[model samples]
Target: MLMNSNYKVAFFDVDGTLADNELPRELGIYGRIPESAKRALSKLKEAGIEPVIASGRNYEKIADFAELLGVDSVISSNGTYVTFQGEPVANHYLSTELVKEMVEQFQTKQTDFLLETPEEILEYAADELLPENILQFLCHCPKEDLPSLDTEKLIAEKVAPTALNIHYKHVSKASGVEEILQKMGISSDQALAFGDEENDFAMFEKVGFPIAMGNGNDELKAKASYVTDTVKNHGIWKACLELELFEEE
Candidate 1:
């Protein structure tokens, strides 16, 4: 499949899309992007394509990776927050009342939980019930950084008004993508999106072209306009080449 190189904006997911899903180890099917892929992204940058990172992580963590990619804007913690350059564009937090209710409900159900602040990710570990499989999949950060929190204390602490996340259900990557567009004064129709998981489904629905990684979920592949090769094979580079988005300077 081919994309319109005329797009003014581009949104990319970090895991399983741009970066290797098996981060920390960088050994997944689409491990770190290849040099060729990096060149292609650079070409897009040179063309004045406004690249945005849409992720379900906190702002600070996403910023670290964005700096490496030369990206200055990010949509983090789903659509709950957006940052342009180093300044915040928009930020949303779960209402204190909403948090109180959800926290009590989660305690009753014993569901593991996480709260994303602009600066940090806080996990509520009830006897370390976090499944190792999920942990392995999110190995981008150090184990020490995965701080355990006392839910009661978290509720007692006054949440700053500017915080961006208070997730109850799974984080919504779609919201992040939408936030980026809203901040950029563009529409999803003006962008190309790349994703690989269920969280990415909502985002794909709004874009003109949605590209899925070869190793992505079946549903995502079914909905995408194009499916690139596995991440490790320079899938992004290959797709850009095929789509004529990577012409040599």
Candidate 2:
């Protein structure tokens, strides 16, 4: 059981933590969020807790799941877009000049990449596909190719050997978390967090109850207050049950 009553909200990482990760080329199936997680959400609300999604995927990628789960706040693209009550609180974008420059680089290098606009992720073939509101870019290439892609405005973080999350500087899930907590009239120590990657570290450092999935990376798990089961095994629900957050009479 959790030892404190201050955990009023929960922040969840979309990939690996909530739903199976299926972006950056969609190499994996777009599986639905586990049913147990849905039930856990209901139970958490009953106990007076709020849930917000924090994911490397952009708003367009996580919206359907957020809608289905009835979540109001979402921190997307690691922190590029943040919303509360389904309204934008933060929308960070890369420089249009920088974005076009990346497109040119990828095309010149003959590598496949995806540009994340507000509405969807698209193959970066030309200027025609670039959206009026750009959010993130994902490049697919060998790890060795990453160094050359880094520029002053855009930086690369490896998601896989072949995929890197390229975004503007100083953006992180913790940045979005701070935005919502401030608007909600609370502090970082008042929330819980769940994640399974290094990208989740910033959020983990900020929240009160940081739970790492069993399948999470070693560094992330080491920092968590508690470690739950893998996402495929109802990780969110299992942690909820273990939390024992029954409302006080």
Q: Return the top candidate by lDDT.
A: 2
Q: Using TM-score, give the best candidate's number.
A: 2
**Each candidate's TM vs. the true structure?**
0.71, 0.84
- Runs of candidate 1 with Cα error greater than 4 angstroms are 1-3, 22-31, 104-114, 123-171
What is the per-residue lDDT of model 1 for residues 142-208, given as tens digits with 9 covering 90 to 100? 3233233334432221122322223433235566666667777877777888888776888898788
Clashing pairs in 2: none
RMSD of each: 9.2, 3.6
Report the Cα lDDT for residue 216, model 2: 93
Give the number of colliding residue pairs in candidate 1. Answer: 5
Report the lDDT tens digits of candidate 2 across residue range 1-249: 655776788998876887755334244323456777777876777777888888777687688767777787888887889988788898888777777777777777777778787778877546475676778878777756543545656567776767888887677889889888888899877899999988888899888789999889999999999999988788888887777654322
Clashes of each: 5, 0
Local distance difference test scores for all models: 0.64, 0.79
- Displacement of the residue 69 alpha carbon in candidate 1, Å: 1.1
